[model samples]
Target: MTEKDPRYRRAASAVKRCVAGEVFLVPVAAGVADVMSLYVLNPTAEVIWDLLDEPRSLNEICEHIQQVTGEAGGHVREDCSNFLTQMERMGLVERA
Candidate 1:
């Protein structure tokens, strides 16, 4: 993933949950639609979200995924990268 805009930040009102093992997210601002969107995150995405409290570089996230998987996560690197790109575009995550 490339560097993101410094001005972008996660809205504190966002809500997320893992239901039936799939992740769901909703932007919880007033006047926003109540309908939540389901995001079927791959294992790599799951790892990335699990570490959201800390700002991590793309390489750092990939390493964490590899550690959890007991092997290099190159197979899912593109998938993870794409997921982050989408999340950034959606304002689901922000650069620190």
Candidate 2:
């Protein structure tokens, strides 16, 4: 699909903010104590995470990034779509 499906969504306040020096992810499932894990994301993945702070559709995110960076550089949209899909699979985002 040229445009992303509008059903994708993200969990609210699910991400814990930490110091800016380094980026890390801590996944803590509610009603399931002692099941926390920390995930380390690379620079590109970190960018995706930052974008995901708000519930934005994949297409919208890609467009924003392209506009902000002033360079698609080729395949940015596809890369962003893939990143968004991965985030959804990782439970970092949900489908609305």
The whole-model lDDT of each prediction reads 0.64, 0.64
lDDT per residue for candidate 1 within 19-76, as digits (tens), equals 7877766666675634655455666666677666567776667677777877757665
Worst 10 residues of 2 by lDDT: 31-40
TM-score of 1: 0.68
The segments of candidate 2 whose C-alpha lies over 4 angstroms from its true place after superposition are 1-4, 31-36, 42-47
Query: Model 1's lDDT to the true fold?
Result: 0.64
Clashes of 1: 0
Q: Estimate the TM-score of every prediction.
A: 0.68, 0.66
- Which ranges of candidate 1 are over 4 A from the true structure? 1-13, 31-33
